[model samples]
Target: MCGIVGAVAQRNIVSILVEGLRRLEYRGYDSCGVAVLADGMPKRARSVARVADLDAQVHETKLDGATGIAHTRWATHGAPVTDNAHPIFSRDTVALVHNGIIENYESLREMLRGKGYEFVSQTDTEVVTHLIHSLYAGDLFAAVREAVKQLHGAFAIAVLHKDQPHTVVGARQGSPLVVGLGDGENFLASDALALAGSTERFIFLEEGDVCELSLDGVKITGRDGQAAEREVRNVVAYGGAVELGPYRHFMQKEIFEQPRAISDTIPATEAFDPSIFGEGAGAVFGEIDSLLILACGTSYYSGLTAKYWLESIAKIPTQVEIASEYRYRDSVPNPKSLVVVISQSGETADTLAALKHAQDLGHRHTLSVCNVGTSAMVRLTGLSFLTRAGREIGVASTKAFTTQLVALFVLAATLGKQRGHLDAAQEANYIKQLRHLPAALNSVLALEPQIIAWSEEFSRKENALFLGRGMHYPIALEGALKLKEISYIHAEAYPAGELKHGPLALVTEAMPVVTVAPNDALLEKLKSNIQEVRARGGELYVFADADTKIVNDEGLHVIRMPEHYGLLSPILHVVPLQLLAYHTACARGTDVDKPRNLAKSVTVE
Candidate 1:
């Protein structure tokens, strides 16, 4: 995934474009580039560094224009280099910025080369500029439509032509592209955050939709050249919502926001109304004999947590599959199987593909648990549950993962009740506990200062180990992922009970061992695991509940969490680990929001 931003008829728009790029940088930031139409030609500046470097160069050179397109690349077809950055130009006429992969770029490149078009950068995006220049007939929109027709695979493209300085044309298929409406100017960005300061009114382009933008307005059309009407949506602005809000990094803020996110995710009583599930979900769930959970990354871990919940609470045999690997496997799902897909973006490529594959295999009872309402996964699935985590900008997921877990837990409980596996008292208890999660999360949020202090020790640590038991094991894996993603720390997660089997030998004083030891059935075993590490001279950091009876003596650093969370301990236990990763990244002086070589969405397989 890469970030694309375009503005038409905007004066001194370089700064605005750069700001938009900064906001969208979470999408991709391997390199940055901007193209401005000046003096009847496209003036392009690009660098293989952070956006700030390119912004400085543009300011120092006084690159000025009204209409422009900028991109922060996450290399796909080529390595990160100045020449490989976007907005790729063609003979001073057209400039293009692309966000998705072009599977048939080699064939297209060969055809273009046969037409005497010489390429500069080894990027599939560069092919678009050349193709547009070759087919230019004074109609930029028509040329874009023609160029897109020749391409294959997922892409969200923004094109700017020197001849049509006041116009910017874009097309989307299998990638996110939003149109932001403004006065005397309009915006095109991969996400709404890019245009947050400029406009709140947006139009989320559907697949196969094409649009042309100018200072006046946006014109919509379809791939078949037919006029298309788009729905204008009023996006609720979460102004400064990305800010830490008294926390450290957005990760830490998001970690603490999980409790509220879970509370928000609890299905309304109206959802239990017979009219909502239609003739009751009993008939639909009754026919299901098995369950499949498909997801990727941290969402995959949430699915794993859900598998345990559904198997234990609902008595439904469940399987958790990583979406990328799921689709390529020969596994077969029966007609009585209920396929559940989990995704934060809901646009995650592999997860969406897995959903499609399951649907193709004739499983119509597919359900999607997603954060975004209009996501591709939502559109494709027959049934859906929405998690209201708002917007997650940090590349490493925090609120989204916890919200997904909450949604899945609710689903599992609902299924248990419908299947006669859970009694009224059990369901009521779960709902009551769910209601108190937000407040319990607030208690965990209070641990931020202590976690930040712990980060100082991590700064000197070259490697770290995360240990947990039962449901907390997945959380431990997630914590390790966060540390490695943002802080570049070599961290690994191991089941506390399995440490003695192999990983215990790797423990040393130089390595910090973070343990998730809530008051669960496995607490005693986890305590012994902690002692095993401490005896090996390894530094110990424990995130335990208040009544867990864990001692804080001798190389043991304990951050007491709220006591007696029961099954909801996973939701609370992840907070300190999230803060640890966030503060550690900050201590390491890493880009806390936009991690290196990572994109917000994996739109490509």
Candidate 2:
């Protein structure tokens, strides 16, 4: 998942491009570069370092221009070195930056090489630059148009011609690209956050759309080779500046923001409405007898948690699919099943493609639980509930995960009411529980000091195991993910029942076993599983409800939760695990926010 920022303005835009890259840093990148059309030539500085380092190079070289393109590259086709950094030039005429994969680059590279074009970098993106340069006959737009026709795979590209100053051409195919509107200027970026501070008006380009940005105006051409009309909507930007405030890291700050995030996602009012999803969502809910949830990464875990909520509370048969594998395998499709896709960015490539695949199979009932209202997933789905988690800067999601659970719980309650499983009084009690969530989350945050103490031991461990029974099993998986993502520890999760089967073989005194113990129906079975772990001399760190009766003893660590939140215990139990991962990563001296070999948004397959 790379980032692209381009601007054509009357004033010098080098600083603007660099600042835009800074905003998109949360998306994750290993290399960065800026190419500007200075003095009628393409001049660029590349770095396999942070954006700040690239900015320093730009300033040291005095690389300023009125029109430019910038990129933050997350290596996919090549090593994240200066040679493979984006803004790859061809014949010194075209400077191009691309996000996403190009599948047929091998053949194209060979063809271009036979035609006397030299490839300096090992990248699929370089093929496009050569193709554009080969097709260039003074019109950069037409060259880009023709070049894209012969290309395969998903990409968002921004190109600038050395001969064509005060203009930048951008195209998107199966990837996100937006145009920012400004007086006497126009902009292009892989995400709106890049242009947040510069402009308030944006045009989210459609798939296969090509945009031409000039000093005074912007033109859009659809895949049909005709001018297309796209809505220019006003949007208020958030998280344009990545301010940590009093927190040490973005991950820590986001963990503390969960209280406000959940409150914003669901209203405290006692009334429940299905129409919050969309205008026709009530009718859609009434028609569906089952649910099919699709997502990837942490969003997939959220979907798994919702499966428990939907089947128990809504009384609907539910199935959760890992989006990447769903489309590749044959599966049963029910027209009556409401297909729900969950994503924090709303632009996850696999999830979006899976939604489209579901539609192709005649599963017309679709809903999106996402954070970005303007994301393509929301636009493509029939119904949507936008989570107000703001911008999740950390690559490992915190507030987004809790807010998604809030939305899913709301959806489940609404479905339960529609199916006659819940009456007015029951719904009001659910509403009351939701009203107390923010305060409960605050109380959970209060346990951070204790969690930090637990993290000191976790930091020294090389491997760990997490366990949970029933609904909390997914929370265990999420906890394992958070630990491995940031702390670089090898961790795995198992349903407590499965521990005696295979995972028990890995347990030892050197192994740390983290258990999510809530006073639910599965408590007795979970306790039995804990005894098995303890018998194997496995160290135990349990986050138990206050009344679970689990306590600290020799070789046993227990951190009591605030209270057992009946249906909402998963939301409360996950907080300490998150803190555990954050603090452990801090202790291990690993990159907590931007972890190794990961990106915040999975824009490419």
Candidate 3:
């Protein structure tokens, strides 16, 4: 995924374009660039640095215009360098920025090259710019529409022209695009966050919609080439949601926000309501004989953890599948199955496709645990639990992962009660645990100093191994994912019992073995597994609960959590791993929030 922002306003929009790019930096930040129609011609500046660097370059070049477009490229086509940056120009007439992949760019580029249109960059977007410029007959919007008609694959593009000084055009086929309404000004971006300061009212463009923006007004065209019905709605963003007031990175701030996020996602459990999933959750649970969880990335690990809860607590046969593979594979779908999809953004492409796949296979009941209530997943699913982890800006998820786990646990408890596995007293006890979760999370956060000390040593290691059992095994997977994703380290997680099979051969004095040691039934077996690591001269980092006997010793490090609730320990154990990853990436001088070649949302397949 990449971010694109365009503005056609009365005053100079250089500052607005820069600010919009900054807000959308979460989508993509490998490289950034801006193009504006200055005086009578389009002026462009691009860099492989952060948005701040691009803003400085624009000021240095004195690039200003009433109509402008900006982009942050995630670089799927070429290297993340200035040459591969967006806002690529076609002659002196057209400038363009794009957000999605063009599957047929090679043929388009060859066709344009034969037409004598010189190419400057190795990007699919450059192909679009050249194609649109080749078709230009004095009308920018019409040229863009004509060019898009010959394209294949998903894209959301914003175009600015030197000739059309007061106009900006945007078209979307698959990726997200929205138009912001202002007084005598109009804005467009791939996300609503980019328009936070400009307008409260927005038009969320439908699939295959194109819009022409100018200071006068906006004209939207549907895929059928007819005037489209536009509905404007006021979106309420959380107060101070995107600010990083006192944190080192957005990832660090989100790690600390877990306490509030977990509390808000589950709320007070005194009432012990089954409507936690939705108003119709009880009926859905009553009819389903099995559960299938479809998710991707960190959300997939949450689904993996939920498999243990659903089987042990609810006593239901459960299966977890990666959404992308599930969509392509021919899997037998049970008619009485409740298919659950988990995503933080609620716009994950593969997960949405998998949900449709299950629906098409005659599985009628669908549910989603999502953060954004306005997301397509929530709209398509029959039931949803909206996690209140507002505006997760970090690409490697922190609060959203834990919040999904919280919501899933609630769903598990509701299912258990529905199936006569949990009595009223047992459900109330679980509710009590849920109510006390926030304070427990606060206590667990106090272990950050100890985790930081571990991270100092962890930064020196090139490789790490995480081990756990049962539900905590998925937490181990998420832990290793967070470390390798942002820290640029090679890490892997395995089931503790599987250590003797193959992974033990790779352990050495240079390797640090991280273990998630919750005091569950497998603690003794996991202790034996830890001894196997220490016996091989591998340093150990153990995250254990308060009641466990794990103590710090030579080659063994233990950080005790406040208290552990059975079936809920995975949520607490994951917090320290997130902090460890964030601090280790910081110590190693790596980009913690925008890691190389990674974007926040995967809105494309």
Candidate 4:
């Protein structure tokens, strides 16, 4: 994924571009660059290092301009080199920063070559920049409009032309783009978070929308080159989500904040209200008989955990899919099924595309469980359950995952009531437990010291296996994912019942098989699975129920979960594992928040 920020103001915008790029750094970038229109030319500085390095370059060169476009690249078209960084030029008159792929760039590049245009970088972005410049007869806007017509794939682009010194042009087809409204200035960025401190007013660009940002205001043009009126609304952002106040890493802070985060995610009500999801949520739940969840990475595991709740509590047949695979594969879609999309940013490329793909197949009843209300997922869905996880800065996704589980469980229980599966007393009991979840999480947070002690052993291990049964199987998968992502360890998860069939072969004395043992009906089966691992000379690190009979002996190390929450057990069990991964990653001296090759949000496919 890449981050783009553009601004046109009366004052020099180099600092604004740099500050915006810093805000977008959590999205992840390897190289950064900026191009500003000053003295009737585009003054540009690029660096293969961090944004701060780019800022240093700007300071050294004294780059000054009123209109500028900056980019933080993840390096799609070429290697992570200075030349491959963005602000690829078009004859010094046109400079542009682009996110997403241009599928027909080779053909376009050859066509540009026919017109005697030469390229300096091996980037598809460069070809488009050159193409736009070549088409510039008099107006930059018209040239950009013509150039975009020749493009073939997804893009969110911000272009700066010397001819239009007071304007920055932005175009989006299949990527996230938004315009920030400010006094005597206008801004464009791949995300609204980049414009957080500057302005709260945002204009979310729709698909195939193009906009021109000037010092005065913004002008929009639709895909057909016709004028369009776009509404600008105030969308407040999570204040200081990137700041690691008093915590070593965001993962650690987020792990500790689980109690408050869960409390915020779950409403403080004596009884569960179906309307908590939104107006007519009960009606939507009443109509849908089945569930299909589309998500990726940790969000997929959240959906997997929800499957257990939806089937057991709501009696709805449910299936979960990795969003990337879901869009490409042919599958039967149920008209009455609720297609749920889970994402924190709500801008995940695969999930967004899959959400649309599901809709294309006549699954119109769509719901999204997301954190960002201004995200594409929420905008595209018919219903939404917005989590109060705030902005999850950690690339490993700690609080977001748990909060997602909370939202999903709420959906399940609400559906259960609507389906007549949960009686009035049962619903009241679950609601009481839900209201008490924050305190339960607080009790579990106290187990962090024990988790930290267990993490010391994990830091030394090269490989590990996480095992769980029933609903906790997804928790096992998520646990292994967190460890592998942050600790740089090779880890895998298996449903405990599948152990003797295959995964047991890798269970050795050196391999630590972490288990999530909740006091559900499957606990006996999970205990049997643990015995099998122990019989094979495998060391076991388990987060078990407080009253579980399994004791710490020989090679078995146990970290007791404070309680066993029936439907919401996964949310509570995940916190200790998060603490485990964070502390282990710290012990291993790995980047606990910005893990290598991992972006906080996957905005590109």
List the pairs of residues colliding in candidate 3.
none
Ranking under TM-score, best-scoring first?
2, 4, 3, 1
- Predictions: Cα RMSD each: 3.4, 1.1, 2.3, 1.5
- lDDT (Cα, 0-100) at 579 in candidate 4: 85
Q: What tens-digit string does per-residue lDDT give for candidate 3 at 1-605?
A: 67888999978888888888888777656889888888789888998888889888888877888889999888788888787898888887788999878999999999999999887778888999999999999988899888889989888999988888899999998677889889999999887778787888889887778899989899999998889988888985432336798998999999899889988988555644567777787788889999999999999999999999989889999999999999899899898999999998877878987898899999999999999886778878889999988888889999999999989888888888888898989888888888778788888889889899989999999999999999999999999999999998999999999999999999998989999998999999999999999999989999998888999999999999888778788988999999999999999999888888788898777
Clash tally, candidates in order? 0, 0, 0, 0
Note the Cα lDDT for every prediction shown. Answer: 0.84, 0.93, 0.88, 0.89
Candidate with better TM-score, 3 vs 4: 4
TM-score-better candidate, 1 vs 4: 4
Using alpha carbons, what is the TM-score of model 1? 0.88
Candidates 1 and 4 compared: the better one by lDDT is 4
Which stretches in model 2 have alpha-carbon errors above 4 Å?
A: none
Residue-by-residue lDDT tens digits, candidate 2, 1-605: 68999999998999999999999999999999999998889999999999999999999999999999999999999999899998999988899999999999999999999999988999999999999999999999999999999999999999999888988999999899999999999999988888887899999999899999997799899999899999998987763466899999999999999998888999645677887888999889989989999999999999999999999998999999999999889998999999999999999999999999999999989999999999999999999999999888999999999999999999999999889998999899999999899999999999989988999999999999999988899999999999999999999999999987899999999999999999999998898998998888889999999998888887789999989999999999999899999999999999999999999999999
Tell me each candidate's TM-score. 0.88, 0.99, 0.94, 0.97
Question: Candidate 1, residue 432: CA error in Å?
Answer: 1.6
* lDDT, model 3: 0.88
Looking at model 1, residue 29 earns an lDDT score of 68
**On a 0 to 100 scale, what is the lDDT of residue 206 in model 3?**
79
Q: Which lDDT tens digits does candidate 1 get at residues 1-605?
A: 68888998657788878888887765656899999999899998898888889889998999988999999888988899888999998987889999888888988889999999899888988887888888889998888888889889889999988888899999998788889999999989887777877888999888788899988999988867798887888886543535666865666666767777777887666233222222434666778888899999999988877887888888999989999998999987787888889888788888887888888888878788888886778767767788999877788999998888888888788788777888888878888888888888888788778998999999878899999999889989888988899899999999999988999989998889999988888888888898899999999999988888997888998988867788777878877788888888899999887787788878777
